[model samples]
Target: MSVIDILVPAGDVRRMHLLVAERLAGKGHDVALVGTDAPGIARTLDNILHFERAALRIRLDSLLDAVPQPLLSLARSGAALRVDLTGSGRPVASPALAPRFAGSPSLAEAARLLMLGRLPDIAVVLDGGRPVAEASPMADSRLSVARGLDDILARVLTLLVIETHRYLDGGAMDARPAETAAPPKTPTSGQMVGTYMLSTVPRQIGGAARRLAFKLHRWNVQYRFHKGRRVADTGLMAGEPWLTLPDDGDRFYADPFPFEWNGRYFIFVEEFRHGGGKGVLSVAEVFRDGAPTVPRVILEEPYHLSYPQVFAHGGQIWMLPEGGAGGNLVLYRAESFPDRWVRHSVLVPGRQLFDSTLLEHDGRLWLFATERDGYGSASDMLVVYHAPALEGPWTPHQANPVRIDRAAARPGGRFVRVGDRLVLPVQDGTLEYGGALGLADLIELNETKVRLTEPVPILSPIRSTYPKIHTLNSSEHLETVDCIAPMLRGGLRRAG
Candidate 1:
């Protein structure tokens, strides 16, 4: 087995570095997690700087704790404070810091441990300069703790995987001399408005009121289609008018998955009641005039279900709507056309999987989903599982997380084949959950290897009045997409 040395900052024991080390070890690599006191040249940031930031976040979250959940969700949606922190970006403080080990020597010795001996084949550094990168929008801002550290851990895992691939592809490891400590540079501010304002009483009240006003609105799915096989851009359907399903104040529908069968276009969606906080599968018929018949509840579950991933196979209709909250990837068979549904099988059990999408290619079934592996945000890692048929005994890919990109990780809609390439619609959740749709071409896909080309955005909520468009689907001559916008209600109306 190849030995790997994980270098971390001395006097720091954050889970960020430990998570990386554990993942490397899990991959059958002999890993030695070592911390060094050697401060790198041209860098003077330390644990103290990170601590201050963490303290601020903790304080701010503590204040937000007083706000109700509905209003708080609205506030966070607008703030979109989770900045992308890939490299050299300042991270918020991490609350998962553990007590560090006794002081150790410099990076030179750490490098020697790798180079001078055959034991450690490579050395990696998970510095403490930036503990947590992108913050999660779901993180509570009122806690006296640094939330969203899992995002950093997830990113670390992605880097380690890439590095491992590089090494296996005949790349050599380099260990350079460690530099002396330099003066710390001035810190910059990139606080989200909600986080920054929660500390003050007056601002806190204003923020709550503003969020309350925002809560008067919610997301409703909308769609527009073209009369072709698959049109990647909406501009191609320029004159086609967009059709939106009317939503009552009590319930909203989103995540539209359209399929054509028996010369009719049918759409399955996630119909969620704002009051119950749970989602159910709903179906509607689409007319050629861009108007949809009244959507009716087709399937209801005790657990939250959304993203009705519907398809036709073997002369049978199957649905795999996201059942992440239920902690599994479930398959439902249509007992009767678009209404009567029965649980077919549990494709993947014991995991929170989101946006489970399937595509049959070359006698193999490929399933793509954003799996929350008990660590990070569900929208950042793309995990693949393959099977001989649509059901049973699915095997995970060797590189399970084939890709880790906040903007293009979650599967949005059905895959579209364009001239020997399968273009996938993915949600760019970097700014906010379900922010936009990005199109990525599947460059290489197989049981052992999976690769996707850089993503090209095909839809943006900014272009239209809608603020979110995460799901898109198309058939032979009909296309459909989903959008989310806020709904406005009145004062006595809100209370009622």
Candidate 2:
């Protein structure tokens, strides 16, 4: 264990500071809080956040919430000393110190980014002016700016703790140059307040209108055939003639995964009914010469389910449907083809794993999924687990969350192998869930590291009549995709 000092603004300590200190201590480190003499803009920011929350009707609790007085008092004393000491001689870190604000740099930078409609990048941690670690923090970007900032700060603090632990454990240091610790175009206090007040009210009103419309309309998936070419081979084009899967005004289908067996093609989807408000696994056969069959429910559970990733293994059909709400990653086997299923084994238990996708490479079975860690969007962090075989024992990668990126972390469909490269379909949820789709090449993978080439966007709402497309899959003769289609209330026409 090592001794570490965490720097914070004096008399303006937030829960994040305490959280960092606690996490360091949990990692068997002797941690101390070092107070620095810097003014805090938290009070002014909090006032603005308060008004925005009320205006937007946001009720979610965030880690940015104030600490209890008793805990605050205890943290200031008894091993948590808030003293005016710098140059501690021991290793030091700061979760709140960035390169922007005159007083509170990190928070000020966060506010500025939110105001500018940009997502926060990874926070760089420096030790003695050298970059030691980098953490890509994430939050739900769909919320109001104030709430987004709050959730981001919370995730940042947690990532800071993890990165610090990794650094002390002889983890690789970041080779990137450290950002200069100087404010450029720093806004004045009046400008910050004025900008938020003038900008957010109109946005809040527009968001309210959208939410009301969403209740009357709903999302439906779309599909198009690629003839002899795969959709992955030829990118989805704008204004292309596409067919919408029929929904009976009360139900919808999404997350399409296509598969071919015995010269027959089928599409699996997450079937969700309006009255039930929960999803179940369903499948429909596709005929090239005739109309597609109606989707039949294949699997259902008490909890919600989606993302029916199916494959044939050992002469048996295997299905790995996402059961995040059921609190585990389950494997199922078809007792009867297309309809009956039996529980095979639980690959991962006691975690909310979303959109679990599997890949086989180099004599190992790899599982990739985004974990819902009780905060932030589940579409940002990608965690990997590997096993020697299809079942039995699975081991998490040394770098569990190997990727932390909102734009490409979530798996949109099965890994597709093209020529000599393996490509992954990813969901770009930077602006909204399922707002776009892209393909990323898996450059490298091992026990300790995983790498992917930058995702090249293929389909987006801006380029098509559909508002969003998240899933992409293809069989030998057919290709399938799912998009968000807004339907009018009590009508079959598309919503305005």
**Top TM-score prediction, candidate number:** 2
Runs off by more than 4 Å, candidate 2: 9-13, 32-41, 70-104, 128-138, 172-187, 214-218, 238-241, 459-463, 492-496
TM for every model, in the order presented, reads 0.69, 0.85
Model 2 C-alpha lDDT per residue in residues 1-496, reported as the tens digit of each score: 6666666556566666677778778889877766655554446667877777786677867656655441322222333212222212233333222221212234655675676556666454343344344444555653377667766765565566666676666766654544676533445667678767666556666766765565432466666666655656655444345677787777888888878888877888999887796899999887765367889999999999999998988789999998888888999998988788999999988888999999999989999898866567678788999999888488888887777778878899989888798999988877677777888999999888889887888844354567566788776666667876765555555532
Give stretches of model 1 more than 4 Å off: 1-145, 157-207, 233-237, 459-463, 491-496
**Model 2, residue 11: C-alpha shift (Å):** 4.1
- Write candidate 1's Cα lDDT for 1-496 as tens digits: 5555444434433444555556656777665545444232112222322453564443322111111221111112222111111122122222111111011112122112212111111112223222212222221122112233223334444555455534544554442322455532222222222223343334335646756675533566666666553446432324455677876667778888888888888878888777788888899998777778889999988899988888888889989899898988889999998889999999999988899889888789998998766655678778999999888689888876676666767898888877777888888765456667778888888777888876777643344556456687877756666665655444222211
Question: Which 10-residue span in candidate 1 carries the lowest summed lDDT?
Answer: 95-104
Query: How far does residue 310 in candidate 1 sit from its true spot (Å)?
Result: 1.0
Pairs of residues at least 3 apart in sequence or in different chains that clash in candidate 2: none
What TM-score quantifies how close candidate 2 is to the native fold? 0.85
Q: After superposition, how far is residue 450 of candidate 2 from its true place, in Å?
A: 1.2
lDDT, candidates in the order shown: 0.58, 0.70
